[model samples]
Target: MFAGCIDIGGTFTDLILYERGKGLEIMKSPTTPGEFERGFMDVLALAAKSRGLSLGDFLVKLELLVHGTTVSTNALVEGKVAAAGLLCNAGHPDILTLREAPRKRAFLTKIDYPEPYIPRKFTCEVRGRIDAMGNEIEPLVEADVVAAAKHLKTCNVAAVAVSLLWSIVNPKHELRVREILQEELPGIPVTLSHELNPVPREYRRTISTAINASLYPIVGAYVSKLDQALRAAGYKNELLIANCVGGMMPPDEIIARPIYSVMSGPTLAPIAAMQLTTDPNVIVVDMGGTTFDVSALRDRQLVITPEATFGMDMLGIPKIDVRSVGAGGGSIAWVDAGGLIKVGPQSAAAKPGPACYGKGGTEATVTDANVVLGIIDPDYFLGGQMKLDRAKAETAVERFAKKVRLGTVEAAYAIYTTSNHNMIGAVEDITVNEGIDPRDSYLVSGGGATACHIGEMAQILGIKRFMIPRFAAGLSAYGGLISDVRWEEAATLHETHVDFAVERTNALIDRLRARGRAFLDRAGFPRARQRFEYAYQGRYLYQSWDIEVPFTLPGDRLTEADVPRLAAAFHQMHERIYTIKDENDVVEFTTWKVRAVGDTGGADRRGVDLPKQQGAPSPKSRRKVYLGPKQGFLEIPVYQGDGLGSGARIDGPAIIEEPTTTILLLRGQSAVTDAHRNYLVELAG
Candidate 1:
């Protein structure tokens, strides 16, 4: 049986198919933005064609298919979501409106507050109260809920959100409200805060629930359509959707918690990166057609954020720490009003794509820059399947060059350099700012555009070593194959080392572990293949904010004996992050977390390597490529990457051309192939 994964990105839909004991086949197609389902089908068709099988026949031979989509993300960012109403406790109607202010602008003379995800008019206050410590302070008024439901029905809301005060502690009132709303507005989906986030911070919780509720109709229809399409195409197995926590969830789970699918595609890059190399501390850089994503792994473990934002608001869920910047092959190059050349945060996405695609785009993009500099072969793009227009690319660059008052080549170079700078800054934010030096970390480059700029970016950050996977263009899709079934469950706790609430902590962790295990069990993972990790989000006494500190107890339950050890772990982590720790000070634990993973039998397995060859390989062709202003354009040897065997070496001022990607070696740089045919580039110090 064959297993495959598909990732629908902003500019490209990547597909990777793997057959056990056979090999891997990868394909990429332009994304169909008007209907993402079409793009999904298009890539499957391409993969089917490559395998020389009918679409239905090929799908029937597959045992599994994992998908990572951007439908929820696109809907949230574009405000094209369903009309969802928010229901909160009486007198707290401003929970969504009075969002937290920017800390940097706290002392400003005037502050312009950002609008909430949901409009204030859609917010309805319900008569209910649940005080702290799981006590019902006031009885829930069912009349209020029914009235709100009728009002929302008149407003034509597709979904409703319930976020009463203290719902995380006592969810009876919230649950009752949901029941009442369902009776009043039949078939309308309702989201309860305690079930979605189940943590503190009202604004964050409410907004996250509201967002999830709003996305219900949109993501529900999307998943249903895709599932029906796959079933119609002759696939019979379960359809797993990638989630933000580096795991795949079933369609029903994703539709229930659509918020987890927001950054799902980018989250898989680190998973693929960790598998590509044995390095414990590694950084993965994925430069796709629309965004550059950076993620890091420490001790071969993913770094997950306790609270990550999807777009501008707090997601309030555990997420893999993948930072993304709008710098990619499709990033537009333009002259700003100040007469400065700026590369994008705005992309010529898939439709009009880069000007070189000859798709009616006139703006010069990063792809155009590479084309103008001869870094990308116009005729050989996509293995000559799709021809790029060199003249159109040059014309596009000339348009921007006139505004910047520089030659076409100079303008293109400026655009490329600026885009690289933006990518470097994003990498720094995740590494340097976190006290993890990029220089000491091994870099793995993925995505279609990464290989072209990895060497230069590595040199800029003083990184000595990096590798490009043989199938770098579809790395994220590849991740879905190796990724394990995973889920996270967390709950808020109030405990301190001084008091050491042992029984309470033990009870909380026990409940969390049970839930996590049940989740894996339901997903068909046996207990023998299940793994659980324990962590606590805490801070020093009197601190305003908290940090997550992972810890291990001596046994399944927490005891007073483990207090000193747990405190030490918190102190050590605190020192590592802030460069300061006070052992004497009390450490307070606020939230308890548990992560469960189900082994998939693919993560640790090594790929079959190609046979080694004795001598240096010959170049298939030569091209005039621009090295820089000083070196101008040099005739560089260009070799077909697939024709090169393992242990083959290519010297500086060369290009290794693959069907979907290109690797450029500048002056004083060289690359060697490993047993797996990966390009291991050694930067010149």
Candidate 2:
């Protein structure tokens, strides 16, 4: 049987078809913003046609159809979410506006502070009170709830969110309010914090509920349209969507809880990098049109962080620890008033695209720089399917040069160098700043723009080894195809180390695992293929911050012997994260968690070996290139990437050109292709 996976990104929509016991087929098409489903279906049709099969014939043998999309993230960035109304306890209608003090920064002078998603006019209050100890100080009056519902109906909001204080301890008030809203406003969506995120922080819970309500209408409509299109195309297999936690979930679940997918598009590529190679510790860098995402992996497992901030909320959700920066191929380039060159936090987007694409884009971009520097061949880009205009690129770059008092080629090359430095700095922020040594990690680079700068980044980070997969451009879609079904379950426990009981801790673990298992089982995973993990939120007795420590349970229970071992593990983790451990202080467990995963075994594709080469060919051509203070452009050799073979060595200055990407080897560097056809570049002293 065959399985299909699709990833819709900001610039391109990628598709992959995996046939068991055979191999994989891939295709790519520009993403259509007006109709994303149209682009998705078009790629599927192209993949079928490439294999000489009909859509119906291919669907008959398909076992699964997995997908990853950026709809939720884009909606939030563009301020295009649904009109939402918020219902809160009386006298606390302004809780969202009274955000914590730590969020405001005084140095930012470019833009004003962002406003809350829910406007003041839409915020309604009801008379109800709950104490921190889960005691009801005042009963939830039915009349108050009815009046709020009537007010929301008159506003004609697309969705409603209800957040009550201490809902995690006792959800009685939130539950009662949801029932009344549903009864009064039939067919309108209602979200409750108790159902979405049952936690202690009032502001965080309120923000998460409001975000869910804001995204409900948009995400629901997108998923519904895609589902109908897939069904009409004769696809009768299970549909799974990639979530921000680097796992797959049923489409129905994603439609109801889209808050889990805010970072879905970037998480998949890292998982694919881990699956493609045998490296235990590595950094995965995925650079797309609008941004670059860098994530670190240790022992082939994605780093999970519980304190991820999403859309103005400190959501305590388990997500892959990814750091994203506003730097990419299509990022705009310009000179500030101080004569300093700047690359973007803004993009030309796919509508006009980069100036080199000759699509009416007036702003200069990194892609245009590569074209002006002779690093990219205008006629050979995308196999000549899309032609670039080198003259237009030079003209755009010269405009910036006149303002900065540098040559056109020099200014363009500076933009390229600065952008690479920015990306390298992002990697350091996540690793070196966090006390991890960069030399110990291998670099995995993917996406259309990453291959262009990987060799330079590797040199700067002092890492010698790098790997680029066979279908590096479509790794995210491939990741969606191979992801396992998973979910996270968590609960808060207020017990201190001195008062903690071994039996109570074990019971909480058991309850969480049972809940996770039931969720996976309902998704069609059998008991034999299921796996469970146990973890705890630990901290010093008086400390406010907590760290997550993972351990395997002994037959669904924690024995007395497990306490000391767990404490030691927590100390080691604390030392790694904070660079110190306070063994004299009492350690306490604040929250318990369980993550259940189901394996979907599939055969791995064998990699193709590179051809043997006796000697490197002479330079096909020479072009002027800049290398830091080496002043004027230096002569560089150019070679086609497909012609290089195993053991083929090339010395800098050189450029490797491929149909989809280009690689530039700077001065004082050497490159060699490995058995799997991946380039490993080393900088010479």
Candidate 3:
């Protein structure tokens, strides 16, 4: 079986061909910013062309195609999403306008807060009254709904979202609202908050639905177009898209709930590490051109956060917890107005890319610094397909060196170390701040730039073991191949144990599970190959956020025996996460989440078979490279990656150069390639 995967990154689109018997092969192509789908196809074509096969002929043997992209995230950041309309309660229609008041600048008179995506003019009201208990105090007036729909259509809204207060308790009014909008707007996408995220907080649910509505048309059209193109190209299976929670789902499911994939690209790095290594404690660092994405794999599970804020809009969805920093090869290096050197939260991004890319970028970036420091080979970058202009890089660094009053090499080293510490700080925020001991975890370097920085970052964080996969540059695409097809359905029925309705809760659980199973069945999963897992999203009394508690099935009802044990588990979990557990406090169940997973059989390859040999690998060449100010510049030996076969050992300071990435081992650190071509770096004991 063949599984094809593509990860559409900011600078490059990575393609992975996972041939069942032949292992995995990765290829990359520059991402076309305007028409992202073109870049997606371009990478796939390169992968096939390299193997002397046409795209159609290549895809015919594939079992599935999985893709991860930053399209939705880029759209939101650039304010390019389609116009949206919101329908809310008649008495209070300013849900989008009356946002929570948190100043753009704390304790300062800054009025730079952005306007809501949906203007007040585009927001209208409907006559409906559902109390907090989900009871219909006043019936939904059809006349008012029709008037709202007419107003939205007149405004030329691309999508309409309906979020009735307390809809989670009973979705009757919200469902009817969608029905009316469908009849009135025809093909226009409509989003219902209860169907998306049915939690207690009205603000998050409303915005989440509104955001979903805005993205539906854009994301849906992109997926549909890609699906059609793939089908025509001879791909016989469904095109699966990675989701917000670090799993693959049918693109149709993503279209229905676009909010579930808000930061889909960043989530895949950690998942890729999860699939490659069996270690329960690992940090996956994807250092691409524009950003450094850091995520942790703990206890064999992807750590997820319930609430994440994006551009002033708080999302109430469970998503992979990945911390991102503006620290990458393309992160611009500049002297701030305060006369201090800063790396970035701003980047040169992909287009003109880094100064060394020789694509007309004049700005000094981390990539330019690497070129100046001789950490990268200008002639060997991108397998020499695109040559790096060493003079351009030198000129870019010299400009910054003038500002800092330092030598060219000194300034370049400054940029490199500055960016390295910035990434270290970011990793600390996710691990140290969360009570995770950095020393207990290993680092798995990913992305095109990841291997370049992994050695230093791991050393600074006190991480002992570090490994970079041979196919690290396209790790996300490889992960997509090994992932399972998953579907999740959640419904809110907020009630404490005091008011717990066992039969009603069990019925709700079964309903969500059925929906999940039905979705899997439609996707062609056999009943035997499918299994349903359950969880309870809960929070303590008066708490704003909730935590997931694994649901253990106990017959069809909540027995008296289950309550204390469940409560104890919640207490233990809270203690572990928050460091505070109150056994006496009232614990409430907010939502019932049912997950359906279809097993797609996959096997991690055994280390490559190399003729058993001993002794260290030979260096292809020698070059002068600048370490930090402490070590200064030193002459180091560089080895071609392909020449160093499996079980090859090379001690520091040595440079292992691959077409896509380079691994730098400092003094005393030794790198040993395993049978699978994985570089496992060991620290000096």
Steric clash pairs (candidate 2): none
lDDT per residue as tens, model 1, 1-685: 6888899887889888887776776788889996999999998888888779999998998888899989988887788999999998889888666666423424666655667777878888878688888888789988888888888988999999888888887789988887888889999999999888877778878888998999999999999999999999999887889999898888888999898898899899999987788999999989998899999998787887765765546776668988888999999987788887789889998979999999998999999999999999999888888999999999999999999889999888888889888899989989998888999899999999888887778878988888999889988988987897777788888889998878888999999999999888888888899998888888999997678788875668777788888889999878877889999999998888888888877564346778896687999999998877888889999999989889998887899999889898877777889987889888645
Better of 2 and 3 by lDDT: 3
The lDDT of each candidate is 0.86, 0.79, 0.82
Model 2 RMSD in Å is 2.7
Question: lDDT score, residue 65, model 1?
Answer: 87
lDDT string for model 2 (369-464, tens) is: 878877778887765667889988998888878888888988888878878887898899789978998889888887777877777788878887
Give the number of colliding residue pairs in candidate 1: 0
Clashing pairs in 1: none
Task: Arrange candidates by TM-score, descending.
Answer: 1, 3, 2
Error of 1 at 607 (Å): 2.9
* The candidate that achieves the highest TM-score relative to the unseen native structure: 1
Minimal lDDT window, size 10, model 2: 600-609
Segments in model 2 whose C-alpha atoms lie over 4 Å from true places = 103-106, 109-113, 277-280, 310-316, 602-639, 642-651
Model 1 Cα displacement at 439 (Å)? 1.3
